[model samples]
Target chain A: MATFSFAVMAVLPLFLMIFIGYFLRVFHVFKESFFNEVTRFCFKVAMPCLIFKNIYSSNLDVGSYVPLVVFGITGIISLAVIGCLFIPLTVKDQKKKGVMVQNLFRANFFFFGIPMITNIFGEEHIGPAVMMVAFVVPIFNILGAVVLAFFQEHEGKKRVDFKDILHNIFTNPIIIGAIIAFLFVLLKIPLFDFVVDVIGDIADVTTTIALISLGGTFKFQSAKHNMPYIIRGVLDKLFLVPAIMLTIAVILGFRGPELAICLALFGAPGAVASFVMAKEAGADGELAGQLIVFTTAFAFVSLVFFIFILRSLGFI
Target chain B: MASSFSFAFGAVLPIFMLVGLGYILRRLGYFPEAFVTLINKFCFEVALPALVFYNIYTSNTTIGQNSGLLIFGALAICGIAAVSLLILPKLVKESPRRAVLAQNMFRSNFILFGIPMAANMYGNDGVGPASILLAISAILYNILGTAIMAYYQEKQRSGKKSVHIVPLLKSIFKNHIIIGAALALVLLSLQIQLPNFLDRTVSDVAKVATPMGLMAVGAHFNFARAKADFRYLMIGLSGKLLIAPAIVMIIAIFCGFRGPLLGALLGMTASPGSITSYVVATSMDADGDLAGELVVFGTALSAFTMFGFIFLLRSLGFL
Candidate 1:
């Protein structure tokens, strides 16, 4: 009961904010221009600040958790590879394939993962969770950039621009944020308390505002056509991936907060960046949006079930 | 005496330097034109909202006690707006330029300058009153600025002399800054606490509003245009930095406002034209160059005017 309640407590605010966004859009409280401008702001500035702050604040004790780090990275890479191969078989649309493949691996770790972990395990135990973010965020960006660029649609056939891919990866604000944050941590450079506080404030709203923006731009018309893809994507992300990844982690003797963190990595909804990347790369942005909405909407159930099972097994 | 002068300098110089840094960065091609727009948009939609919300939410003072400040702020803004609307168009002769001039005259750079200046004078305790004033003033500025700009824009566009209230109201209501202020006020009044994580995140994001806004303002400065609009620019500068503030300060003082309250009011009246004025002017198809010029001149000259006001107020034992 406690775990269930915790799950609800964790996820309700996110959904509520998204709903407020949708409501505001319906009521014309915010215009399309407002959402577009805000989405760009989030993509460029807020998300980067969030990524940088998250990694910078985390204590990266890489040596102590080699196996967990190894398993986490291996899990993400394997999923990306499998997703790239498998998505083309199911999704006929060239643009959607990349978005599907990308989102299948890139969970909303920063937005959904970090908050849920903090809620369940307490903030003091968030070091491992933060460390997971340190590794996973860069991998997500690089993989996302490469995949989107590779599957970018063109009217006439043109080869993929490898230079564009590299540029995209390097110039990605979130990736840059992570790299800068990692350096800050490595160099032991102290950020002023106010600076961190300020970053935290910006980072704090990334999830809510991003969700709101997502809700504001959401198209129910597209959802009717994309229901199959949306359902499949949500199930794969929330259930299949976590089921496979957590089983492996458990078999490898992972348990408790570590297992929970790993579960979050595998189980959280698609990263909001997936939608942004899709839209920017001319991929199937609608599908990406649907996947984020559906996955985020139902992520609570998966989270509750996972937390309950882990707690019942006395692992968390 | 020297200490007070230095204190006044300490309060004002960092802000000036930041604006200068923004100008230099833009000149050196460090911050691209698009980057300036992005920074301003972020300031408008996210940072400024967060700043307002956080300040209002965390303030210890009740709204009841600060009703006086709120009333004084609303009246001051309405007074300025009324005066500007009644007189500026006749002087300027061109509708769009008049709209820009009137807006520049009435709308002070309160978010960037007012809050910080107040904080500099009286610390966090001062922020409550300053923030309340900011919220009221920002709403007024948007409503009045939007109406005036839209009216002139419609006149120019359709070659008709009628103001359309519906579209004007829509634009005013849709403003994110005003929405943010209204939300903050509601939450503050209800005594609702944002969760700790959310609170910290908001305050953190809010911290960027002032610096980013100042920087964006500096980046938007056009030196050539400033030269072109030299006469109009001087009118705007004198009105924004000198005349308008002097009037408001005298009124605030007569109303028994002293210390940080007077300082906050002075900051509101004396600061530069708001960046939003330029944004609205451009969006409304008004004279954006002139709007930008007014902002640049108002901001550039404000460092001296603000110093003068602060020093004078302090000398008079009002701050």
Candidate 2:
């Protein structure tokens, strides 16, 4: 009972934040322009600073990261492979098929992962979780680019070349944030105290802003026309991936923070960035957006159940 | 005083760094021009109020314990405005610019920075005094700001457009931050509590206040504008960030203020010029260029001044 309540406590407040944002938008307190501008600020600047600062400050301790790095990479790839294999069976629209595939694989670890780790174990124990971004973000972006690039050509659009895929993955802000932090850690580069504090300030604000902005962009009307597709995407993202990856994790003897991080990396909502990537890559942006909302809207229940089950089994 | 030097350094450094980060990101073309304006609206209309309400509601310290903050803050604001009005007419020469200077001297960006700085110095629960100060000072800022600008605008324009009591009251009551603070106070007085989920929601929203508030301030900072309007900029920066706070610090210390009380008071009197100064100035037919320049440059130079004052106060054990 205690563990179950802890699970509820862990995920409830974060989702309530989104609910606050939705009601604020409904009352017209947040206008249309707010959604895009704040979202842009969060992803482009604050999110990067968050990942960068965490990895930079963390002890490199490479002996410990073997599980997270190895499992994290394979976990994402397997989910992507699973997504590629199964999405066409579930979705009909070619553009939205890519979005669903993207949804099934990509967890918004960039947005939700850090906060969830912080929520469960407190901020001090979040280093291992933050380092997960260093490995996870690149795979998510590369796969996102490739999936969307291939599906986009069905609309008679020119396929994005392999070089462009490499370029996009390398140029992604969150990936760059991770890369730079890796350099700082590996190279033992010492930042001035003031510089660290400044970035820390930016890092501190990232998750809350990302969550609220995600809420501001929440539109019920967008989901009205595509409830069936949305439900399938949410189910695949919130349940199927976790049921698969987390099982593999337990089989491999993963437990504690690593296992908790895996749960966060797999079980949370679909990536918010998937919507933007879809819109830009000529996929069904509306479906992408809907998947994000419903998955995020439903993520609380899914997370509580997963966490409670894992805790009862003593897996994490 | 665990190294007062480091204490002050920790508090002031992040603020400048945030502003500098915004300035650099903007220079590199990451922040579009529109992001600054829109985010400012987000902070004021949404984040600032939520921060104040959350801080006051969650605080165990009741209003009676910090009642002196209300009295001290009000007196200091009114005192400085009186002084500025008495001395600035002969000093500034032009009626519009004088009014702008007068307004800048009395008003700091207290609503945005008050809780954040207090929280920064003394953690989240320590912001009770600051939130109480916010509710009172927010109303005072608007009333005084409008009265000062309107009085001089009338004087300069041969009595064309001066203040009206109804409009003034309406403007104060209409402001989102003031309304938020007022709501919190009403609930506080009645000993009402928000339902658990709603209470948590406000706490979550309030967490965004400092970082976003600082980022928005940083993004709006205009470095190039500093070079053109050197004179008014000097006066506004020196007066608001240094001299006014300096005078108020003596009074506070003499009255035995210390710790987070002093930090909240510093936020009230020593922060940068309010961005709204430009809006209020131009609306009253004042010199928009000088007002804009003062605000732009005041914010830029405030980093160094904030560091100095915080460092000094820390060394003195008044923070």
Candidate 3:
């Protein structure tokens, strides 16, 4: 019961924020363009600052968490490989296969995962979770870009811009933030208190703004039309992936907060980036959008269940 | 004295640096024109509101405590508006230009510049009064600006004159700054403490508003257009940053307003012409170019004028 309440407490504010975004959109308080721009700002500016601050402040020892790091990387890569192989076989449409595959593997680690971990473990003990982000986010981006590029609509007419892909992956704001933060931590550089305060301020609103924008941009009409694909995508993301990943981690002797972090990494909603990548890459943007909405809507139940089970088993 | 000068300089320099960086980044194509607009929108909608809300909500001071400062701020704004309305018409002949000039002279960029400056001077204690003053001043400027524009516009169109109260009220209510302040005040009154996560999230996002706002101000600075309307521009700047503030400060000091209250007033009175005045002018078919020039010049000159105010205030031991 305690774990259940904790999960509810953790997820409630996030949903409320999304609802506010939706209300604002419906009431014409915020225009669609405003939501888009704010989301981009959150992703590019605020999220990076947050990741950097979290990792930089953490007393992370890379050498100590080698097993967990190895497990996380292996889990994501295998999930991507499995998604790539299975999605194409099931989905007849070429454009949709890539998006589905991408959705299957890429969790909302940046938005949902980090905040969830912080909630469950508290801020001081989230070093391993931040480390997971540092490893998972870049890999997710690279794989997402590659998958989108592979199944781009005009594949025969236009060659894929490898430079753009590499640039996007390398210059990704979250990745850059993680790298800079790692350097700061590794080199033992002391940041000014005011600077840290300012960064902390910027980082604080990232999740709230992102969640609101997610709600604002949500298309219920699209979900209605793409119900089957959305359900499949949600099941794959919210259930199958976490189930496999957490079991693997538990079997590998991972326990407590480590397992909790794994659950967050794997069990959260499909990333909003999937929709962005789909639209940009000319894949099935509608399906991707629906996937995000459904997964997000159902994520609370899944998160609560995971926490309850983990707590009951004394694994977290 | 030297230490005070350094302290004042340290408080003000980061703001200028961010603005300068914004100008350079925009010039170098690092931030596209669309991106600049987007950043401004985000600041106004999300960041600035959050900052105001958080500042006011977290403040231990009550509205009753700062009622004097609030009343003084309202009176000062009204005084400036009245003076500008009476004097600006004689200086600028065209009715639209007169209205825009009058509005620009009285309406300072209080939110972007004032709160931060006050906070710098008095730390956390300053923010409470500054934010309250911001809420009051924002409403005053909007209503006064609309009335002036409407009066002139009516004269130009059909010679029937009355402020469009409905639309004006709609705008005032819809304003994110006003909404933020109002919501924060409500929360404060209710004794509601936001959850730890929510509070941290808001502050983080709210922190972006100052730097982003100053940078947007810098990025939007127009050199070419500013030179075109030098005569009217000078009038607007002097009225906004120098004459208006000086009069207000003397009165405030005489009224026993000292410390953060005085600092807050100085910060508000000494700010530049609001960027909103330019938007209002352009949309209302007034001398938007002149309004734009006033904003650019008024803002450019304000950095020095504001520093001088801070210096003088500190020297007098008021801050």
Candidate 4:
């Protein structure tokens, strides 16, 4: 019962902000262009600062990296491979296979999941979560590149350009941000106090702006057709994948903050970047958009429910 | 919280340092005006609102707590407007220019400057007083601005006086600044509690409001405008940036305002002339050239004046 209130207290406010964003849009308090620019700003400026700052401030144990890293690094790849192979059977359309594979495999761990951790469990526990984000981000990117590269192949770019994949992976804002922060941590780079303050301040702005941007970008003028694919996408991304991962983490004896972190990272909605990638790749962009919308819209209730259950069961 | 931490020099330094960074970056051609404009808009529409809302929602401050700041802020604004109205015509003979000068002298960029100053001084909770002052300033600025402009235009036309209350109220109703502050006030007054994550998110964004806003204000500085209509620019700026603030701060001092309350008043009175003066001037067919010059000159000169004023106030232990 105590944990029940804790669950609500931890989760509800972040989700309420999305509705506030929606209402702002509905009342015409904010325009669509603001949403587009804010989304870009979050992606380019705010999220990078946050990712960099989190990793920089974290205290990592070199010995402790054995279990969490091995699981994180290998886990994402296996999931991506399974998604690429399995999703194609159900999701026809060469275009959709790529985005579907992305939708299933790419969790919004950094944007939504990481903030949720700091909000619930505080920043001290973020060392492991940050490691997960650092390793998981690159894996997600490379997998996304490979999957999209395969699908875009059908559009008559016959050569599988290895150069393009490398460029795509290295140049991703999130990956670059993570890499830079990692380098700073490893080298013990000393920064001016005020500069650190500025970085820390901007880093903190990420979650609110991202959530509000999500609400603003949400399209109530959604498509009527292909409701099934959207439903399937939401379930696979929010429910099945998270359930399997949480159970696996539990069986592995992960508890407390680590268990909560797993639930959040695995349970988060599909990555917003997947939609951007899909649009750029010319693959079922509308479907990708809807998948982002529904999964995010539902993740609030689902994530809260999961937290409540886990807390009650004393599993986390 | 304010008792535990003295933000006197610590808070004031960050504002100017970021502003200096912005000015240097702008001068080096690294941050262009268009980029600063976008940043300004982002800060104004999205981030600043969240900043204000976060401060108001998270703090245990009530409307009654800030009634003094609200009353004094409104009174000081009206007093300035009255001075401008009574004195501007004698100083500037042209009808359109009369309205422009009055608006320039009366309006201050409290939103950009006030919130940041208060936030820096007293931290997040201090924003409650600052925001209430902001709402009062916005309301009075619009009312006085429209009436002053309409009064001049009416004189030029030799026609009946008219002030569009409905449209003015509607605009104020939808204003993003008021919306943010108002929503928080309503929620607070209703004894409502938002989710913790929401407040946490708001706090994160609020931390950004000052640095980005101050830097944008710095980048917005145009030294080239120093040569444009040099004499009148000085007149408008001196009155807006110096004389008006002096009058208000003196009155506030006599009223026993000190500490964070004094800090909030300093934000209200001592900041530069508002950027909106130009917009309102042009739209009202007033002397936009003079309005534009006053804003640029006032803001540019204000960086120096504000630093001095803040330094002086800190040394005097008023804030």
Worst 10 residues of 2 chain B by lDDT: B1-10
> Which 10-residue span in candidate 2 chain A carries the lowest summed lDDT?
A153-162
- When 1 and 2 are scored with TM-score, the better candidate is 2
Query: lDDT by residue for model 1 over B1-319, one digit each (tens)?
Result: 3543454445445555555666886787656787676556556665666665665566555558889988888898889988988878677888888888888888877866778777777888777688778766766776677778767876787686776777666666675655766787788778787875467456645666665665566677777767888888877788888999998898888999988788778878888776567666765678877886676656656777887888888888888
Tens-place lDDT per residue, model 1, A73-132, is 889989989998888997998978998898789998866666677667766676677667
RMSD versus native structure for model 2: 5.2
Tell me, by DockQ, which candidate is best.
2
Q: What is the interface RMSD of candidate 3, in Å?
A: 4.5
Q: How close is candidate 1 to the true structure, as a TM-score?
A: 0.70
Candidate 3 residue lDDT tens string, A219-252: 6673565677878888888888988888889999
DockQ score, prediction 3 = 0.23
Candidate 1 residue spans exceeding 4 A from truth: A1-6, A12-46, A53-68, A77-104, A114-134, A137-173, A184-233, A243-263, A271-297, A300-316, B1-71, B128-139, B154-222, B254-256
Kindly list the interface RMSD, in angstroms, of each predicted candidate in the order they appear: 6.9, 2.4, 4.5, 3.6
Task: Estimate TM-scores for all models.
Answer: 0.70, 0.80, 0.76, 0.76
Q: What DockQ score does model 2 reach against the true complex?
A: 0.44
lDDT against the true structure, each candidate = 0.74, 0.75, 0.75, 0.72
lDDT (Cα, tens digit) per residue for candidate 4, span A1-316: 7777777766666676677678768878677766776677677666777777777877576467667567655666777789878988887778788888888778778666666776677877776776677677767777777787777745455455678777876887777888998898889998766666666766666677777777877886656786888888888888888888778888888788778767766788877778887887777888888888888888887788888888888886
C-alpha lDDT (0 to 100) for residue B66 of candidate 1:
83
Q: By the DockQ metric, which is better: model 1 or model 3?
A: 3
